[model samples]
Target: MSNVLLLFDKMGQRDIVTWNTMITQLVKTGDVDLAYKMFVEMPERNVRSWTAMISGFVQCGKPKEAISLFTKMEETCLKPNEVTVVAILAACADSGFLDLGSKIHESSDNNGFTRNTHICNTLIDMYIKCGCLEAALDVFEGMKEQTVVTYSAMIQGLAIHGQGEKSLKLFFEMIQTGMKPNGITFIGLLNACSHMGLTNEGLGFFTTMTNDYEIVPAIEHYGCMVDLFSRAGLLHEAHDFIKEMPIKPNAAIWGALLGGCKVHKNIEMAEVAMRHLQELDPFNDGYYVVLANIYSEAKRWEDAARVRKLMKNRGLNKTRAWSSIAVKGMVHEFVAGDDSHSLSMEIFEKWNELLVQMRLKGYVPNTSVILLDVDEMEKEKFLSRHSEKLALAFGLINTRPGETIRIFKNLRVCEDCHASFKLISEIVGREIVVRDRNRFHCFKNGTCSCSDYW
Candidate 1:
């Protein structure tokens, strides 16, 4: 990379291709900031240069910047080609920019990319990630041809959205089309079965995946199977399955079991899972947090304190949680107790008003999710200021009463927030769609699409 840079630097008459190559190479080498600098320093940029920079932003986890650059490109009236469209679409997906994503979908159609399978697949993914499952399905249904990638995205989308039965139906239909299910296909199948508690069916598919398809199980496949059994409340069986695995169980495999243990309130099994996790991934704060959460759930305050102390001793800090909501094509983000937004006062006031109404609707704050050793009132206050709740309040303040509120969270939704969201949705008479770390939670009329299962 240094040599290439040096050679490019020595070139006296660098053209657009040379500049684009250097920027693309820098992006490929994980120097997105440098690439952006070069992009800015360029005498002028063609579509390729803009595309490269946008793609770099997406790759480097700067989706908002990618969206910003794409907007600038649009202002220039330089039509994006397929590559630019795909790159920016990915940014839209990552940042939950559904409004921009929908616009791109229309642009793609006008630009004669509707039949482009790759773009269509990306469209499906963008819609799914944006918590628009029906839109994703619409894109899938409108496709003239579906690849394994397309099928995989749709299947996973359905599974995560709590449409396990429909996901399985799609898989069977895929089989009828003679497309041949791959490892990814089976993973999606296993996830569907896991989410819906189709234990025997999941096992059957696992067996068939190996014997009939000759696909060797990767760590992900093994992880999915463990998740299946663990989610099904078969902790002992999941343990035995891990023991019998041909390869060593990774942190994800053990973590899946721990997650199930938390869901089922199996402290003994949760400890067992933690013992392995400590060895496999001791530094991962998520594992320690989960164990602490389990102890808190069981009212083992001392044990929870001990786990937290252990984390402190190991110099581990809990991952900061945040949630985002997009309004008027601009994304607004909130952290726990965040007060930095311009509408902070309004957000707090709106939430206070909603809480009064929510309480009237029989909403009692479940303070258990807060592991802190504080008074119940303090704990409830802390819970009320959670990032997602702030985002929800902000959304309610900014949007019309009947408008749907969509949010994206960086971590799993807490039990307290999940329960409160159901009541809040009912009180507000609007659909609240939240895409969290685990899955989609669409709350409407006092029920979640996940059926409170996720």
Candidate 2:
């Protein structure tokens, strides 16, 4: 980025395109704060400039900032174009801001911009991301001319919601219309199958993707395959598949296999995955954490301790799990044992009440997943203060009883929390949707959408 800046200084005058390109690249590189610095220093702002910054903020996980930037852009003379609408819709999608997303759709209509395929597809994606599957279906049905991307978005939406069969049916419909599927389409299809444990169907789709469609498998495609096999406890097949891949497997591929190992408790395969992961990404704490967790799970105390010691020696620490909930356009963040909010006391009080209720509902903490060598009671205590639980407590305290509670978790929901949420959702008589790093878990009536599989 500094080299690009030096190149910029060499130019007598830089155009908006040059500035926008630099800003966009910086944002993509995870330097949004630096991108903002460049954005503010621009001589003049256009729709592109505002849109770039808004999109950058969203990509940086600052959806509220993106919306703020969009509002500021509206106050100016320039009307928001299709590109600007797509960026803001993405922000709305990431935050599950359905009401605000509707406003964006209406804004496009008011601006007299043509409802092109790109904008319409983005709308589909936004609705899906916000957990409004019916609304996404409505948008997909309303489109006049749909592209492969449109189908891909709809497929991904269904897949995430555990509607693998519906997504497959749609794939058939898409091909019947004589449109060839692309890499994105197959990724969505395979992911749908993977998440739903439709192993046979997923493998079938994988074969069809490469043999029939002639889409040379990308690393992402291989990752999905590994995930599908690994989640099914077929550790040997997944390992062999990784070895036989035409292209060399990367960290993501190994990570997917490792995740499966974690789920299936395959200590040997987890060790193999960790060895490759260490070579590929030496600084990533996740590999070490998972390897240690596998040892802890197996009651291999000395091995787990050694892994933790190695992590400390290498100056690597586990990433803190964080979660946030949006209520009435305001987002509240919570980390494990968090007490920083103004309603911290009230939140804990509500949490205590929840614990009593959870106990009455026969909730037993799953201590096997603690990953720490501690007493069972201490393990339970630590689990109670997890980020998702705190966020859920805060959501229950603030939101209406009948409203759906949506929380975003930065990591996979812990085993104990996942079990606890099942009871909490039934006891509270409200739908609770937790979007974790893996997939959306909609807890309703004492059951999770994952069906104890994930």
Candidate 3:
């Protein structure tokens, strides 16, 4: 890389090709900042140059910046090709910029690019990630030709949205089309069974994937099996399954078991999983937090304090939770106890008003989810400021009455917030869709789509 850059710098003159080569190499090497600097220094940029920078931002997990760059490219009147659209759609999806994504879909239709299979697949994925399952289904049903990638993306989307049965049905449909399911396909199938608590069905699929399809079970497949057992409250079975695995377990495999332990409140199994995780992923703060929460739930205060001290000694801090909602083409973010927003006062006031009604509807804060050893009043107060609650309050104030409130959170929703959202959805007479680290929760008519299982 240094040699190529030195020769390029020594050149008498450089054209777009010479400049683009450096930019592409910089992006590939994960030097997006330096690539952007070179991009601005370029004598001129074509669609390729803009596309490279935009794609780099997506790869580096800077979706907001990628969307901004795509906008600038449009201002310069350089029409984006299919590659550019694909990259930008990914940015929109990550940021939950559904309004912008819908516009891009319209633009693609006008430009005759909807027929492109890659673009269609991206559209399906974008819609699904943006919490627009109906839109995703529209794209899937309209696709004249479908590939394994298309089916896999749709199946995984359905699974994550808590639509396990729909995903299972889709898998059967894919098989009927004579599409050979790959490793990715089976992962989605197994995940569907895991999410829906179909332990027997998951085991059958695992067997079929190994014996009938002849696809070697990867670590992901094994992890999903553990998740299946764990989610079904079969902690010992999940543990035994891990012990019997052919390959060595990674942090993800152990983490799956730990997640089950958290849900089932199996402190013993959680500690067993953590013993492995501490060696495999010592720097990850999430594992420590989960273990501490489990201890706190069981009133093992000393154990929970010990975990906190270990995290502090290791220079680890809990990941602050935040949630985001997109309204009027702009994304609004709120952190736990956030008050920096311009309308923070109004948002809190609206939540208070809703709280009165929610309480009347039998809403009670589940204070157990508050891991701190605070008094009851303090715990309830802290629960009200959770990131998702703040985002939901902001959404209620900003969006129309009948419009759905969609929130994306960095972590899993706690018991208190989940219960509140169900009541809030009914009180507001609108649907609320929350996408957390685990899966989607759709609340309407005082009920959740997951049926309170997840």
Q: What is the C-alpha lDDT of each candidate?
A: 0.93, 0.87, 0.93
In model 1, how large is the Cα lDDT of residue 99? 99
Query: Which pairs of residues clash in candidate 1, taking residues 3 or more apart in a chain or in different chains?
Result: none
Whole-structure CA lDDT of model 1: 0.93
Residue ranges of candidate 2 with Cα displaced over 4 Å: 1-35, 42-44, 58-64, 75-78, 95-99, 112-114
Q: Candidate 2 lDDT (Cα, whole model)?
A: 0.87
lDDT tens digits by residue: candidate 3, 284-353: 9999999999999999999999999999999999999999999988899999989899999998898899
Q: How many steric clashes between backbone atoms does each model show?
A: 0, 0, 0
Clashes of 2: 0
TM-score of each: 0.97, 0.91, 0.99
Which lDDT tens digits does candidate 1 get at residues 135-251? 999999999999999999999999998899999999989989999889998888999888888999999999999899999999999999999999889999999999999999999
TM accuracy, model 2: 0.91
lDDT of 1 at 374: 83
Better of 2 and 3 by lDDT: 3
- Supply the TM-score for candidate 3: 0.99
